[model samples]
Target: MAAGEPQAKKLKLEPKQLSENVLFGMGNPLLDICAVVDKDFLDKYGLKPNDQILAEEKHKELFEELVKKFKVEYHAGGSTQNSVKVAQWMIQSPYKAATFFGCIGKDKFGEILKKKAEEAHVDAHYYEQSEEPTGTCAACITSDNRSLVANLAAANCYKKEKHLDLEKNWKLVEKAKVYYIAGFFLTVSPEAILKVATQASANNKIFSLNLSAPFISQFYKEPMMKVMPYVDVLFGNETEAATFAREQGFETEDIKEIAKKTQALPKVNTKRQRIVVFTQGKDDTVMATANEVTTFPVLVSDQSEIVDTNGAGDAFVGGFLSQLVYDRPVTECIRAGHYAASVIIKRSGCTFPEKPDFH
Candidate 1:
């Protein structure tokens, strides 16, 4: 052994005291520019066929020219941000929420997000960076309200040092009863996730996660594996769940096995209850806890019309979290989640229903 060698200190986590009502989220904040376009518009813009495209200024200019031929709308978006917004609306109870993220140039997009948060009564504190333009997502919608293009940009710069002050923001995180995170962030910057997860562990936080996109699972196998033990509640759809199962070397066909394996993961704290919730479109949603497995049937409106499916998953997470934070029964929570998702699917974009009449 070298006598003069420096030694690395072992990381230690001590639980901090926290209230039972606050919630905090960490992720990217993006602006969504949504528009309904027909085949003519698609052809006029020369938007390549299939999957969303992230374009440069030239393409954006061309897109702008094409959109001038149709109608367009803009809204604030980002998976975690949307979830927090929906949760705030559904809870209808006074709750404190803090979001940590980077925004580009105090532009209209950033202003709109701040205004929307304020309108929803959410405490909006953000760090504005100057290197890049504010991030945006151009959602090209068809006449049927189905999204054909999701152009993402600028929102991809959330790095670890960007969250170095997170502990100082611990008051905001600890004041909240639950901490929500999205898998998309993990894919973007796992170091940022590790920073948050370590702090949440030390503070005895009820950590929750949503699989933001189906394909996120494929790119984040190791990172997800490392983060799961610190997670208290996990939300995902069928595609995400199957991807997770495959990543863990389990066959998707064996649902029971997947559930069992997921439930058996070590908990961050023994006193905490761990759960995995899988949402199957039009099929029953399944929840797995250490000692029990429950299935809740999806609630479908008698004459439901699909307007737009964007943010539906985020709405479901918001609904579930709103109920769960209040210590509602799992069954009721699942129902609330489905109810929220149903409402969003019948709307043009990610929006809260005027009323939560979940009978």
Candidate 2:
């Protein structure tokens, strides 16, 4: 599914002409507790601006502090969930255009996540449990930078047999033409990803994934390696690419070289060559295949209009997936991804307008 292959021939169809469950995404779903707070609040939590870290014992009070003292906003904030929501918004025709699967708790935060997913037109089927009280990320904003403290409460409790392997849910897996997951999910349920990726490859469908964060390559290498063979389209930023290259013993930090090597990795499914996309903030986006490396300059924004940089990567992939499901070419997918990312960076959190005005 390299954007210009025979499979891409499906691009002849309009973007909105897709059926329900056209795209399927799975990962941890977290409620984003977002608000603008002063430097004193950040110092109190021993957090610095622009830092993303798991919640520590010392930071346990931050979520409540944000809710108690500041004007906060909540948005559905998991990486895969955000992408599918953006994809649904871009497609905008058949409601429930994108289907998402994840585990959450039977708590208020989980309720909010479901409500937000519905509001975004994403068909969410969450595995609700009571042992833990939903996962959340406190997005403490100071000017343009955000400090994130995530509490992966129920997010870590995903068991494959409980949801993904069920007959009723597996039907959605079979019905989708494109399957996506964030590498962050490797921490929660790589077994579930293996199940979906194997099925997607066996069925000759497009299977895409992201190197969600740098630590994923460093800490989750075993699971990442097990599923890499089934990936047709891989997305990440230059930073994550460099980290993956170093961690996988690729021995190079140059993104073009890394992309070329990644494309050449052993793939079980021989239908198409793996295509890798690495985004460079404020520089050219690099796309690589077995034959060539191409670059696309990103849209530039003024310093005054930028609101938040969080969720830009997920938004980019969502926009790309919107076109991929429609069989749109790789170039168009990149353009749409850029459009989506640009729109999101102008707003707070991963929230988007009612409809996308993609040209």
Candidate with best TM-score: 2
**lDDT for model 1, on a 0 to 1 scale?**
0.68
TM-score of each: 0.82, 0.93
List the candidate 2 regions with Cα displacement exceeding 4 Å. 1-16, 46-48
Residue-pair clashes per prediction, in order, are: 2, 1
Q: After best superposition, candidate 2 residue 35: deviation in angstroms?
A: 1.5
Q: What is the C-alpha lDDT profile of model 1 across 1-359, one tens digit per residue? A: 46433332222222222233376777767777667667665666566433334455546564455358657676777778788778777765453443445444467767887777767655655656655666676666664334434333445655456544556554555566677888877756777677667677777777888766656667777887788888888888776777778877776555555776787877776667788888876778889998888888877754448777777778888888877776778787788899898888787778765567765
Tens digits of lDDT, candidate 2, 118-220: 8888889999999998999898888888888889889888889999989999998899999999998999999999999999999899999999878889999
Clashes of 1: 2
TM-score of predicted structure 2: 0.93
